[model samples]
Target: MDEAVKFHFVVDGNDFTSAGQASVQIKKNLRQLGIAPEIIRKVSIAMYEGEINMVIHAGGGEADVLIYENRIEIILTDNGPGIANIDLAMQEGFSTAPDNIRSLGFGAGMGLPNMKRYTDAMQIDSTFGKGTRISMTVNL
Candidate 1:
């Protein structure tokens, strides 16, 4: 492709049922673009995790996907209470999700870790009480 293809989505914070819509759509779009299944899988997983995080923590957010020749990038931005300790947040099995959220089997503290594990590169920018932005890339 001469130019990167971009897709944007707005995640609804109040609706847990609709959290993963963006990632599902992205997976379909990537498949139509002839992206490899593995790459698509990685991108979808990372994007989904980010989306869920936005819904669970941030009151809602925006997700953007850029499809380039060599890589696919997913950017998630949220304006909720930002992560206070990114280091602790990244640790496995560490979560601040409410007991109600846990009852729904949503927050397992694996979102950030899984996002990083699935993507070739990941970066997180967060400000306490402000917001957070996460960018992840998967190589084709």
Candidate 2:
């Protein structure tokens, strides 16, 4: 693509049923754009994890996907209590999800780690009481 294509989605924090919808839509869009399956998978996984995090912790958020000729960028923004420790949060099996969320099998503390694993690059910006913004990119 000569110019970047963008897609925006609003996640509903009140409804767990709506989580992951943005990633699913992004996957379909990538497939339709003829992007490689592997790249699409990476983007989907990373974005899905971010989406779930927004729902479970951030009271929902906005996800924006930018499709470029050489890469794809996923931006997740939320206005919720920010992560206290980035290092600890990045560790596998480390989660702050509530018991109810865990009972539903949603929080395994693998969200950030898996997001990093699947994406080529990921960055997180958060403020303890303010909010968080995560940006991830996948090479095409």
Candidate 3:
């Protein structure tokens, strides 16, 4: 692509079955574009973890991915209750998800941490009653 390419996706919070659809699609699209396998894997994993967090806590969100020459940028935004503590939330096992949500095989509190683990850089902007936005980048 001559210019940066953008992809938008709407995450559905009601259904767990469809939570990771966007990430999967992103992976496929990158593959078709001949993106490096390592870069694609890292971005896809980070995006998938972010998507699951939106479903498990935020009730839904919007994800925008920008594909550029040397990097991929992912921005995930949601209108759910904002995270109360970024520092605490980054801990490996910290979680605020309901017990019911935990039972569904999520809420391990690994979402943000895992996202960071896979991406080169990540930042979270959140307000108590407003919402949250996370920006993550995976260098190509």
Candidate 4:
């Protein structure tokens, strides 16, 4: 592709049942484009993790996917309580989810770690009490 193809999705924070919709749609779109299954899987997993984090922590967020010739970029932005410590949040098994969320079998403290693990590149921009913006990329 000579130019990037873009897709935008709005995550509904109030609905746990629809949390992974964006990731699922992205997976379908990638498949239709004939993207490799491995690449699609990586993007789906990363996007899904980010989506769940937004729902459980941020209250909601917007996700944007940009498809490029050499890479795919996923951007998730939320206007909820921002992460206080990026370093700590990146650590595996370190979670701030409440008991209720954990009871739902959703908060395992692995969202950020898993997102980073599946993507080729990842960056998180967050301000305490303000918001967060995470950008991740997967090589094509």
Candidate 5:
């Protein structure tokens, strides 16, 4: 690609049924763009984890994917309760999701860690009461 291509999505927090739609769409888009299978898989997994986290905690959020010649960038932003502790939240099994969300099999606290694992780089900016924005990149 000579120029960056961008895709934007608005996540719906009220509906668990629609939680993964964005990630699915992204996967399709990446595939259609002829992205490598490994890169597409990484992007899909990372995006899905971020999308689910937005639904379970952020009430709703915005996701943007920018496809560049050498890398792809995924940015997720939400206006819900921000993460209280970045270091703690990055742990494998720690979660702050409510009992109801946990009962629904959505929140296991692996979201951030998994996102990081699948991406080349990940950055998180959060305010306790305000919101959070996570930027992740996957090199091509």
Candidate 6:
């Protein structure tokens, strides 16, 4: 596409049923734009993880996606308690999710790591008591 297209969503915290809605919508949007299926899958997976993380830990948040000629950009921001240790949080299988969350099979401590893995570039900005803002880009 010659022009960039943007989409936005509001995530509802602690709402398991609605957690992946943004990703699903994004997937549809990408498909409608004729983006490659593989690319759509990767973007959907990454954004879904981020949305789940926001619900489980961040008490909900906002997600924005921009589709451009050369890349897809995603931004997730939340006012929930920020991650205490970025390095530790990035480690696979390392999670602080509550027991109730684990019972639902939602928190495997794989969110951030997977987000980074799927995206071409990822960045995290957070503070202990403040909040977190994550930005990710996947090359087209």
lDDT of 3 by residue, 27-58 (tens): 99999999989998999999999999989878
TM-score winner between 1 and 3, please give it: 1
In order of appearance, the predictions have TM-scores of 0.97, 0.97, 0.95, 0.97, 0.96, 0.96
Candidate that beats the other on lDDT, 3 or 4, i.e. the better one: 4
Per-model clash counts, in order, read 0, 0, 0, 0, 0, 0
Model 1 spans > 4 angstroms off:
none
Give a tens-digit lDDT track for model 1, residues 1-140: 35889999999999998889999999999999999899989999999999989988998899999988888889999999999999999999999988888998977999999999999999999999999999998988
Model 6 CA RMSD to the hidden true structure, in angstroms: 1.5
Candidate 5 per-residue C-alpha lDDT over 16-70 given as tens digits, one digit per residue, 9 for 90 to 100: 7788899999999999999999999999999999988999898989999999999
lDDT of 4 by residue, 28-50 (tens): 99999999999999999999999
For residue 102, model 1's alpha carbon misses the true position, in angstroms, by 0.7
Query: By TM-score, is 3 or 4 better?
Result: 4
RMSD of 5: 1.3
Q: Total clashes, candidate 2?
A: 0
Model 2 Cα lDDT, one tens digit per residue, 30-125: 999999999989999999999899999989999999988898999999999999999999999999999998888978999999999999999999
Off by over 4 Å in 2: none
Please give the lDDT score at residue 2 for candidate 6.
Answer: 73
Lowest lDDT 10-residue stretch of candidate 6? 1-10
In model 3, the runs with Cα more than 4 Å from the true position are none
Kindly report which residue pairs in candidate 2 clash with one another: none
lDDT of 6 by residue, 65-88 (tens): 988889999999999999999999
lDDT of 5 at 60: 88
Question: What residue runs in model 4 are displaced by over 4 Å at the alpha carbon?
Answer: none
Candidate maximizing lDDT = 4
